[model samples]
Target: MVTWLGAPSVAALREALHEVAPQLGGGAIVPRNLVPDAAPEWSAATAVLAGRYVVKFAWAEPAALRIRHQVRVLGALKVSAPWLALPAVVVASESPALLVTELAAAVPFFDVRHLVGAGGRARVAQDLGAVLARLHDPDVLAAVSAAAGPLAAPVMPAATDALRRGPAAPAPDARWERVAAWCDWTDRVLGPAPGRSGLVHGDFHGGNHLWDERSLRLELVVDWETAGPAEPEYDLRCLPGDCGMELFGAVVDAYERVSGAALDRDRIMGWHVRTVLDDVLWRVEAGVPMPDRRTAGEWVDDLGARLAGFGVGG
Candidate 1:
């Protein structure tokens, strides 16, 4: 579920949905044209409706299994959040590899960048971190997973193979070699810190988060295509890796303040490396130009340096 709906012939997907939902019969479903206010970087859909609920359906290959798993996880989180703005997944169908979630009235975290200089950034940071920390709590972990059902054993080497063989842009032979070596190193180091792993949101980049600029309120974290159990640090790395430490320092500090748990220096750097490699692999596999890799690499290197500065090494 890490990769997203490319120019997937939505025709196949739409056909699948129409068959399963069947409510689209005869005439038009008005929400068919209803796109969300903000678009997620990694998904193809905008909105759908079954009954009165508004849903956003994200498509993915090999998503049949992951979507099944996510419906349960989000269902539990729906209960866990209680009063907060959280999405309750309504349907997941393998025919189109879709997960339908209740749509919320928030903007993408990136879309609200205009408010970053305002007081809202800090509060958003606090809320984001607190949410992750709260979800990371051991009790929360057991409850979420027990409700989600059994987790698939994460296969680092297979994933590494997918990386080398999948969508990231092709580097010079030299860079590819370096990336391959780093993958091996990551498997050895980062893979082990997956202790007490629960449902990890594999992708938590700003593009996936929704927030209210005026109130600094976090809305639905829309993309669960990558949601499931893994390492806690892996999820922690999600924020720092994508948003840059300057933006995420507030989040980390806020989470630490409330959780009273220190971030593991070892796992932080290790997972940071994993995130960097993942971006690289994604660009390469997608057959995008290599220059895009250089640009993304600069950002990731900056992120790596920041992670190391967080006292994370190895």
Candidate 2:
């Protein structure tokens, strides 16, 4: 498993660039930090090289395998979905833990400071729906699996362990009890369904999506480090409340229209709730402060309200 210690200093990065220059198709490479200064230890600090390529060095040998997996997935996509704008794999190395790819001319949809009008929002929803449709397609999944080997094990166990390691004890507050109950509910309801699995971009929220401001389209999808096989709902979970329920509905409607299948509302809702709880657990374990010091009851209430709006309920 990868453990973060600290980012390499400018000098260290410079030495790394010097070493890898030959593999990069050689130029006077300039390194720019892809990670923000405030990011936590779990995230890797990537570098943009020569203004055209992005390079990420893993923290450990195990992490290097993860990068290799992503590279294979990208290579497979290059053949299966040529229309999708994804980074082209430039170089991958197991030793010294490196993966490099060409940079796409796009920005995460969340980073767009300018307001998008209703038309723009609809377009974004439709684009996402269609791409997600492709990702979940049976044909695409088979092709990617054949090319990249099977997706790795699910990440939930590690997440659960992290949550349990938090310092908070049950006696101090009823919040732990509430959290326990939520976990119990999730276990009973959210187990994966056989034959329902598909290719999932493990983190498919707006923050990971890159929008082409000039073309007004989703030109590229970035951060495939966690791509795998999972229920289709894993990708849709974060999208259900984006913009507003209306836009969420637009995404769902478009997805149904494109895929010729009804959205699995129950499963999606269950995964969304579990995802929210997992996020809270991760934050707590990381020693990061929670918003309003969120309690279990409050989280449940919020979940209830959000689901009700989508015509789903306990």
Which numbered prediction scores highest in lDDT against the true structure? 2
Span of 10 residues, lowest total lDDT, candidate 1: 25-34
The C-alpha stretches of model 1 lying farther than 4 A from their native spots are 1-19, 24-61, 80-84, 88-98, 153-195, 289-297, 304-314
Estimate the overall C-alpha local distance difference test score of candidate 1.
0.58
Q: Give the alpha carbon lDDT tens digit for every residue of 170-253 in model 1.
A: 443443434555456556665553566555566766767788767767877766656666666767665665566676677778
Candidate 2: list runs displaced more than 4 Å. 1-12, 23-43, 157-195, 241-243, 289-304, 311-314
C-alpha root-mean-square deviation, candidate 1:
6.5
Error of 1 at 294 (Å): 7.4
Output the lDDT of residue 314, model 1: 29
